[model samples]
Target chain A: MRRALKVIVLGVWLLITLFPLYWIIVTSLKPKAEIFTLPIKYWPGNVTFEHYADLFSFADFGAYLLNSLLVSLVAAAGVTVIGVLGGYTLARFSFPGRGALMLAFLVTQMLPLFIALGPLYLLMSDLDLLNRLAGLMLVYVAMLVPFSTIIMRGFYERVPVALEEAAQVDGASRIVAMVRVVIPVMLPGIAATFIFAFVQCWNELFLAITFIDSEDAKTIPVAMNSFITQYDIDWGSMAAATVVSVLPTLVLFAAIRRYIVEGLTAGAVKG
Target chain B: MRPAFTLRKARFIALCLLPGVVFVVLFTYYPMIRGMVIAFQRYNLFDITSTPFVGLENFRAVLAEDRFWTALRNTGTWVAVSLFFQFFLGFGLALLLRRHFRGRGLYQAWVFFPWAMSGFLIGLLWRWMFNGQFGVINDLLLRTGIIDQRIGFLATPGWAMTSVIVANVWYGVTFFAIMIMAALQSVPKELYEAADVDGASKLRQFWHVTLPHIRPTLALIVLLRIIWILNFPDLIYSMTGGGPAGSTDIITTFLIQQVIGGDYGRGGAVGLLILGLLLAFSVFYMNATRFEKAR
Candidate 1:
């Protein structure tokens, strides 16, 4: 009986969590008239991809998708590449102000993305980079580096220095030792950092909305805004768009979900 | 092969590290320092540096502005309310999920999904859910006979704040649950078994065993989230556009207005003020946590 009750409770919560997601998928497939039917049909009797087709045909969604892909991909690659090198240095070398430098990096990460909003905007304007994809890439990369570096630094700090030294003593170069030894061992951290950077870039909103205005340059979140104006909501198409938008992230989550969960827990508790 | 991975003598490490340092300095610290100067300069609405400095002028105007106070108050309220619920609900939900169960992985993903969503999207989603006329909430509430009329949740001041809080709590709870659940799972099971053998109740066991074990995790969450909650902007911007009567204005939104209003100096002043408060909170939270640990 207790076991039955536990399952029931879990079932209820799961339904609550999954319904909105389910609602979007079902609503997306349903025709407009059926969407608002009195009983609110939980399933679509007529499943069609009209809304999805409309989403791609009537909208610049393809551009937004490419932009989102480019910005996030660039940010992920940039943050990881930079983070790996800097993180390695911080982890291995004991330079003066090392602790202070690490603390400063944490402080930078702590600062709200908008803390420098005014100046960053002015600087962007001055450089004539107001809506440039390259500019957005620059901001995303800078914003993500500290978090990535911190994670990478922790992973690098853990590798047995003796192993690296032994290899070096055998006449292997430092670069080779790091490449062959430190990096392979740190793959999990590297993977986690990449996902972390990509998610952050993808999820960024305030700056994205504020900076980018052109149809060709818009990302998914910004592109989706036209569906829900203050007056009326295009629920069906909006739901369809939302699902399409969420699909990639869902795929991303499934891929790195394990790394993300473990790293997040370790990051908060250990750091 | 011999010198490809050469030692400390090689300049490769410095070369490798240079690009990242340049990136951070140019994008992060440069803007930070430059923003400080903007707080002083008149910031030629058209020409930037051509404008003359007007020391303390921008600060005075910002302090005198009524909307600035509104933004600050709402920001404080927002930070306090979000931090409170995020901890309680997150902890509560984490405890609920701690027990081993079927489809645990699926449930975990469902709860964790919102945190991964862009704030812009979450803002848009909640806006639909809270729509005054055709919203899912109004439909449900009306069907249940809870109210005769729609609540106008994001329009009225009292409800507007509540609306943002509810949305924030929805997303915030998952963050806490994910973090806390991990730490909770790491806890040894023997302690619970030992407590059961000692005839201790679940509540007592939770208070004495689970609470202490996860205090560090809780403290860390609280410290970090205080800053994050304070900084979050889309929660304000999308929901109400800082709404009905500037009722939901927060510092970040206020800064946006300053930028749009062409008052970069005043906006920069607000920026600096916000940065100061953020720093204070960080130090305060860290010290307090340290004090609690020491005692």
Candidate 2:
């Protein structure tokens, strides 16, 4: 009896968790006439690809997708590379001001980026960077570098220092030792850090909406927000766009699910 | 080591670290300092050429608005209520998922999926779900014979905050479950076995063994979540835009409106106040936790 009750509870929670995602997917595929039926159709009677087609043809969603992809990818790569170098420095050496730098990074993680919005906007406009993709990419890189560097530092600390020492003993310089020996072993960590940063940049909406007003420079989240604010929200197209927007993050997260708990808790748990 | 070799190593370290430091300082710290300065100036977007020092005029203007106090009260309710539900429900979830079961890995991934979604998108999803005319929620309620007629969840002031809190609870439970589960796993198996040998009931064992073991983590995560919930305005922004007479407006959303409305000085003042609020809470939290540890 206890076992049965446990199973039933789990099953009910599972349904509650997945029902919204399932509903959105179903809504996206349903015919327009069938969506707002009196007694909401639990299943779409006639599935249609019309909404997905409309996203491409009428909505100009392709540009937003490309923009999101470019910014997320470039920023993820930039943050990961910088994180590796910075992580390595913090892990391997104890230099002047290192402690203060590390504390500053931790403090930055706790700060709400909304606090910087007003001045950031003014500064970006002064630099002629508003409504530009490159500008958005720079902000993302800065925002992510601190957390990614901390995760990377945790990863670097796990690898024994003796391996690099052995390489240096074999007539390899410190730089070469890092490039050839340490980096090869840290590939998985690097990938996890990159995916974490990528998802953050991909899902960012506030800064994107603040800086990029031009339709051409808008990212996926910005496009979706604009769609929501329209006079008559096309529910079908909105659902379709949401599905497309969420696919990349969901896939990337699944790939790195194992590292997520560790990566997220490393700073807080240790402190 | 030789002086030349030490010098070369120091240069290499600096080379590795410079880019990260420069980017952080230029983007994060610089804007924050400038934002603080802007709070004291008459920094209007309409007349940016002459932004003179105003000596707390911006602060006075922001404080004079009744909307600011409403937002502050709503922020307290939003954070406290959301945190209460999220912690208990998530703790239950963590307990339920602790025991081994078939397909557990897959189940965990599926349940934790909401944490991977954007807050703005989650807001949009809940907004549509709560729609009175064609919403799934009303449909479910009617079919279940719970309500006689449809009710607008977002269009009404009273229901809007409740609706958003429900969505937040749905989204945030996964995070607590994940973090708490990790903390639970760190408790050694031997400790549980010893508790069982001592004739402890499940409830007693939980109180004595599990609670004590994870208290620090629980305290820290709760504090972190409090700060995060207060700062998070994306869901409220996209869901109701603090609608139905600004009933659901939180401090962060209020600040966003100030910025979007072209009053950077007021926005900057709001931003500084948020910073001050968070810093004050953090200091209080740290001291309380330290006192607990000492006891």
TM-score of chain A of each: 0.92, 0.96
Runs of candidate 1 with Cα error greater than 4 angstroms are A1-5, A30-48, A225-233, A262-271, B1-13, B44-50, B186-201
Cα RMSD of all models vs. native, in order, equals 3.6, 2.2
Where is the poorest 10-residue window by lDDT in model 1 chain B? B1-10
lDDT of 1 at A46: 91
* lDDT per residue as tens, model 2, A60-120: 8999999999999999999999999999989988777889999888877777777688788
**Residues B1-295 of candidate 2: C-alpha lDDT, one tens digit per residue:** 2124377778988898888888889888999888889899999988889999999999999999999999999999999999999999889889889988999899998997886788898888888899889889999999999998999999998899999999999998888888999999999999999999999999999999999889998999998888888878999988898987999999999999998888989988999998899999989999998888778
**Predicted structure 1, TM vs. truth:** 0.90
Clashing pairs in 2: none
Docking level for model 2: medium
lDDT of 1 by residue, A1-271 (tens): 9678767766675665565566668878998888766555657889988888888888877888899989999988998999999888877776555687677677676765565666777777878877888889888887766677778887887888888888888889888999988889889778878887787777676667667888888888777765554376677788888887778777777777777665564333211
Winner by DockQ: 2
CA lDDT, every prediction? 0.77, 0.88
